[model samples]
Target: MKFNRRTFIKRLFIAAASIETFFLIKGSISKTHLEKDKKELFNAGKADSFEKNKPYPFLTGQFFLRRFDDGGFIAMSIKCTHLGCIVQSNIKTGGFNCPCHASQFNRFGEVLSSPATRPLDYFPITIKNGDILVDTSKPTKRKSFSKSQLTYV
Candidate 1:
C-alpha cells in the first residue's frame, strides 16, 4: 500500500466514524433493555438487600433508598431533571432537592416545583442475597423496587 496523507486521513475518519456508530447503537440497545435485564447483570451490587428502615447509598446517580413510614421502600433519584445536576439530598427534609435551581422532588421522584418538565427519574430496584442493585443507566415507565442491590451488611 502506497502511503499518502489524504488516504491516511480518510481511513482514520472512517475508523472513528464506525467506532462511534457502533457505540451509539450499543447504547441505544442497552437503554431499551434497561428494565428487562437489570436484575440479571446486577450481581456485583444487588438492590434487594436494602432494609426497610434504612436509606442506602445508590449507584453513582441522583437517588437513594429509604424505608417509608408505611414500611415500604422508596428510591429517589437525586439528579435534577432540569439540567442533570446532582440533586442534593436533605436529611432534614427527607427528600432530594436540586441546589442548582431549587428544584424539589418528592420521595417518589415527583417534581414539586416548576422549571422541571419531567419528574426525577426512578430506577427499578430489588434486594437479592443481601445487596442492592439499581438500574441507573435508564429510567423505565413502570418502576420496580428491591433492596438486594446495595452491598451493605
Candidate 2:
C-alpha cells in the first residue's frame, strides 16, 4: 500500500461526507421523536398567581391568561382570527390589537373592530389542586363571551 496524494484526498473526502451524513440523519431522527411526543398542555402556574384585571402571556406567547375582577380565569388565544397574526394587549384600550390588519378584540375575545369577521379563539382551562392548566389542543371560537367560557377557581 503506497501512500499517494490522490488516495489520501479521496479518503479524506469520503470520511468528511460520512460524518456529515451521520449528523444529518441523527438530527432528523431526534426531531421526529420530539414531534411525536408533542404536548399542548400549558401550566399557567397557581390559580391565585394571576392578578385581577391583568393579562398574562403564556406558552411562548401563544395565549393570554386573564384574571377578571370577578375572580374568573380565561385563556384567550393570541392568534388573530383574521390573518393568524399574534395580537398585542392594549391595556389603555382594554383590548387586543392585531398589527397585521388592525383588527381589534376586547379582553373577552370579542371583536371590537373589523377586518376580523369572527372573534378571537379561546382555550379551555382546568384547575387541579390550585394549579391552572390550559389545554391548547381544544380551542373554542365564539362571537361573544358567556359564563361558560369562564373558569372560576
Candidate 3:
C-alpha cells in the first residue's frame, strides 16, 4: 500500500469528481422539491393598491401587475420573448426595455420594437375577496395584445 504521486493525484481526481456529482444530484433533487412545494397562485395584494393604467413590478414573482384605465388587471411576465431576459420598466418611455438584447415592450406587454416578435407572456388574474391573485403556474403566450385578455372587475 505504498502511495505514489500518480496514485495520489488519481485518487484526488476521483474524489473531486464524486463530490461534484453528489452536489449536482443533490441540487437537482432539492430544486424539484422546491418546485413541488411552491404555490400555483400568487397573492399579489389588494386590488385597490394598484393604480389605473400603471405598471407595478413584482420583482420576486417575476411579473408585473398592470391595471388598465378600465379597471382591468393583467399579470404580465417580465421575461422578454426575444431571449428570456428580464425586462426593465421605463416609466418615462411607458414601456419595458430588455437589458440583454434591447427589446422594447409597451405597458400592455405588446412588442414595441423588433427582436421580440411576440408579446410578453402573461399569467391569468383572478380577483378574490378584493385581493388580486395571479396564477403563476401557467403563463400564456400571445402574439399580440387583445382586449379579451383583460380581466375586468
Candidate 4:
C-alpha cells in the first residue's frame, strides 16, 4: 500500500477519536463502581462526644451532626437546596449560610431565607451499641422540623 497524506490524516483522526471515546467510557465505568462501593452508613462517633446546642460539621461527608439542649440529635446535609453549594454553619447567627446564593437556613434545617425554597436535607440516625450511625446514602428533604426526625439517646 502507498502512504498518502490524506490517508495518514484520516488514520490519525480515527485513532484520536478512539482514544477519547475509550477514556470517557472508562471514566464513567469507574465512577459507577465508586458509587456502588460507597458506604451507606457512617459512624459519627460516641453519643457522649457531642455537646448540647453545638453543631459538628463533617466536612468530608458534607453533613452536620447537631445536638440540641434537650439531648436530641439530628443529622443534616450541608448542601444547599438552592444551588447545591455547601452551607456553612454560622454559630453567631445560629443558622446556616449558603455562600453561593445567600440562602439561609436555621440550625433545625428550616429555610429562614429565600433562594432556597426548601429546608436542608437530613439523613436518618440510628444508635447501635451506643455508637451513633448516620445513613448518608438516604436523605430526606423537609420544609419543617418534625419530632420523629430527632433521635434521643
Best by lDDT: 4
Estimate, for each residue in 131-151, the C-alpha lDDT of model 4 and write its tens digit. Answer: 889989878888699878999
Number of the candidate with higher lDDT, 3 or 4: 4
When 2 and 3 are scored with TM-score, the better candidate is: 3
The lDDT of each candidate is 0.61, 0.88, 0.89, 0.90
Model 4 TM-score?
A: 0.74
Off by over 4 Å in 2: 1-39, 59-61
Count of residue pairs whose backbone atoms collide, per candidate = 40, 0, 0, 0
Error of 1 at 54 (Å): 5.6
Number of residue pairs clashing in candidate 3, backbone atoms closer than 3 angstroms, sequence gap of 3 or more or interchain? 0
* Residue range 54-108, candidate 1, lDDT tens digits: 4565555446666654545545565677898887666665556887888876655
Clashes of 4: 0
lDDT of candidate model 2 versus the reference? 0.88
Candidate 3, residue 152: Cα displacement in angstroms equals: 1.9
Q: Could you tell me the lDDT of residue 133 within candidate 1? A: 53
Q: Say what the RMSD of model 1 is.
A: 8.4
Candidate 2 local lDDT, residue 153: 83
Error of 1 at 104 (Å): 1.2
Off by over 4 Å in 3: 1-39
If ranked by lDDT, best first, what sequence of candidates would result?
4, 3, 2, 1
Model 3: per-residue Cα lDDT over 1-153, one tens digit each: 899999999999999999999999999999999986675888999998888877899988789999888888999999999989899999987789999978899888988887999999999888899898888887899988888888876
Q: State residue 147's C-alpha deviation in candidate 3, in Å.
A: 1.6
**Worst 10-residue stretch by lDDT in candidate 3?**
33-42
C-alpha-based local distance difference test score of model 1: 0.61
